[model samples]
Every structure is written in structure tokens, then in C-alpha cells.
Target: MSDPATSPERHPDAHLIQQAEVPPLDVDGVQAASVGTGVFAVATVIMAVGYDTLAAAGDGWWLGVGISGFGLGLISLVYTNDRRRRRRRGEKLSA
Candidate 1:
């Protein structure tokens, strides 16, 4: 006798799971990083422009937040670009 839990015939959604085959999309990490960095750069500029108003409202930390985000995004952009270049050149990535 087969266990009910182990039997695919008794399991709900078993057929659906077996038929699920999603194709992977080809994506560029460098492009994604560039977009993220651009967004952070814009946010930093907006924060800088609103610093005085935000400070008066006790929200001056927004500027620091923006700066940190932009800095991190820049780092990501550089890292992604380097990785993409290395990949194009067939270099093995360091684990």
C-alpha cells in the first residue's frame, strides 16, 4: 500500500507543479546597477535641495540617508560593471 502523503495522485496541485516550467529571462546586472545608481543619485540631489526644509522639520537625517544610499549604489554599480567585464572575458569569479 502507498502512503497517501507520498503519492502524487493523492497530493493536491501535484499536476500543476509537475507542469510548471518557467523560462529564465536574460538580464544584465550592470544595466540594473546603473538604473539603481541613477535613482539613488537623483534621490541624493533631491535630499540636498530639501535639507534646510527637512532640518527645520526635524527630518535632517533624510540627507544622510540619501548620501548613504547613493554611495552604496555607486559601489554596486562599480562592482557589477567589473563583474560583467570579467564575465565577458571568461574570467572565473572568485567565490
Candidate 2:
């Protein structure tokens, strides 16, 4: 009454299929963004005090750029963590 082709034991490789573990989005993005923010902060301080100090008087344009970079990194980190939280709750992303 049993067909060999339809039997699971007939195919030993059937149970061997394994799924790879996926990395969490928040962990990946947050780490990178935090590092970026720290780097930008350090660079901003160095630029504000080190280079062309007499001319810019700590108001250099590069300081603004570095601050912007830090802000953007923090925003991205927050977004990434929020996405991870939503995913854990099994909520779908809205358009």
C-alpha cells in the first residue's frame, strides 16, 4: 500500500535542509551608526580646536558637517531599533 517514491525515509536528504540564521537589523545598524557618531564627534572636536583655529574660532563649517553626521547616525540607529522592535512584535510595515 506504500509507494517508495512517496516515503520520507526513502529520501534521507529531505530532513537535511537547514535555514541560515539571519542577523537582526538593529544590532547591525546600531553598532555601525554608534561608531560613526563617535567618530564624527571626535573629528568635530579635533577640527574645532586643531586646524585653522585662529580663522574659524571654533565655528568652522566642517564642525557643522560633523555634527550633522552625528545627528544622522543617531537618527538611523533609532530607526533601525524601531524596525527591529516592530519585527519582533510581528507587525507589518506600513506604507
Candidate 3:
């Protein structure tokens, strides 16, 4: 006379997992940005050598270019990490 099927509102495992609770935000970006800086350092050295030979520029000038590139790359990395942090924190990015 009645429907034979029934659905459980919530599973036991799911309830337990929810009760445990987790940290709010993840710090993956902080770690990755640090590594990226190291990579950019090496890349700058390589670019310096290349420019020195290709343009016949002096060591000082090439060194300056390499240092500048390295700084730019690092700044970019930091900005990227800030964006990631905002995303993980559930904050909406501004349009």
C-alpha cells in the first residue's frame, strides 16, 4: 500500500568527517612562491651569460639586466601567491 524505497538524509561517514573540521585556508602558494624564486635566480644567471655573448655587452651591464629580470619574476610570483591565498580564503576577486 506504500512506497518501498527510503533515502537517508545523511550518511554516517559524512557526518563524522564534517564534525572533525579542517583548517580554513591552505598555504600551498607560500611554498610554491619560494621555490619559484629559486628557479628565477638560476634563469637570470643563464640569461646574463647569453646576453653577454650575443650582444658583446660587458659583465656589469649583463649582470644588471639579469638582476632586473630576477626581481620582476619574483614580484610576479608574490602577486600570484596573493591571488591564490584570496581564492583559498573564499574571498571573491574584485572585478
RMSD of each: 4.8, 8.7, 9.9
How does candidate 1 score on lDDT? 0.80
Tens digits of per-residue lDDT for model 2 on 1-95?
88766886777556545689997764436677778879988987887676687355755677778779878888987987887688788899785
* Residue-pair clashes, model 2: 0
Please identify model 3 stretches exceeding 4 Å from their true place.
1-40, 46-59
TM-score of each: 0.72, 0.55, 0.43
Where is the poorest 10-residue window by lDDT in model 3? 1-10
Which one is best on TM-score?
A: 1
Estimate candidate 2's alpha-carbon lDDT, on a 0 to 1 scale: 0.75
Instruction: Name the TM-score of candidate 3.
Output: 0.43
Q: Rank the candidates by lDDT, best first.
A: 1, 2, 3
lDDT, each prediction: 0.80, 0.75, 0.67
**Which candidate order results from sorting by TM-score in descending order?**
1, 2, 3
Best by lDDT: 1
Q: Give one digit per residue, the lDDT tens place, for model 1 in 19-70.
A: 5588755243777777877888898899898889999999999888888988
